[model samples]
Target: MYPFVRMFYQAWKNRNAPKLGLFESHHSRHVCMPWDIDLWLELNNGRTLTIFDLGRVPMSIRNGTAKVAKDGGYSMAVAGASVRYRRRVTTFQTVDMVTTPIGFDDKFLYIEQSMWDQTGECCNHILLRGAVIKKRKLVPPKELFDLMDPTLESPELPAWVQNWIAADDTRPWPPTR
Candidate 1:
């Protein structure tokens, strides 16, 4: 089940947070609950992605994208992601999560997120490609930005992220063994 309550709480908690520009980071804090752990007694890999929602949604809200999405009758979806887990988070361990919009191409927006342990070490990081949907069609990032804030233009995507996207494009769909 989705953690709607926690998501709502995060939205409310950050309601007064300073508005962010396109390239600014949105910082949020979270803890590893019992349910978030796996049989190995650490935060589950899948749960990490789910928990990332807690940060990303609030980031959209803080940056005014959520409001624009709602008003425009659009929704955002994650199209692709690459993640790296470097450390284990045990039960009750607190982590500071940071989310930022790296940039967008014509079709997709790229977001970078990271979870840092209490001692300021990065535990995990993820790069996600997202698309906005409107009337069953994918809305280009430029169009979405025009609707949200015309003055705000997407920054250039980093070279590494562009490389990843290129690599993904080369992979054939419908795997053949």
Candidate 2:
């Protein structure tokens, strides 16, 4: 189940936050609720991804991408993602999440997010490839960017992210069983 209530809370909490530049980061805090745990009693890997949406969507709102998407009648979708889990996040533990737009290419907008424990140790990190869509068809990121700010240019993507992109390109789609 999606954390729709928590998502609304996050959005409401950040409604008055200062508008951020396209590449700026959005900082937020969240707790690992009982339902967020797995059989091992740690944050579930799948739930971690969903919680990431709590950060990304609000970040987009603060950065004006949400407005652009709304006014243009476009929707944002996650086309791909890669996550790395390190430390354990147990129930009731709080974590600080940072989300930032890494860059964009011709097709997709890239964003990075990480969750850190109160001790400042990173528990997990995720990289997302997002797409703008209209009428069920893909829309170029540049089109979205143009609506947000014509002068906005994508920052250089990190080499690791580029490598990940290159690697993903080699994968067969409609994956073989």
By lDDT, the best candidate is 2
Candidate 2 lDDT (Cα, whole model)?
A: 0.95
lDDT of each: 0.92, 0.95
lDDT per residue as tens, model 1, 1-177: 777888999999999999987778999999899989999999999999999999999999888988988998889999999999999999999999999999998899999999999999999999999998999899898887898778877777889999999999999986787
Task: Give the Å shift of residue 72 in candidate 2.
Answer: 0.4
* Candidate 2 lDDT for residue 128: 96
Q: Kindly report the root-mean-square deviation of model 1 from the true structure over all alpha carbons.
A: 1.1
Q: How close is candidate 1 to the true structure, as a TM-score?
A: 0.96
Candidate 2 lDDT over residue span 1-177, tens digit each: 899999999999999999998999999999999999999999999999999999999998999989989999899999999999999999999999999998999999999999999999999999999998988999889888898788878888999999999999999997999
Model 2 clashes, total count: 0
The candidate scoring highest on TM-score is 2
Global lDDT of model 1: 0.92
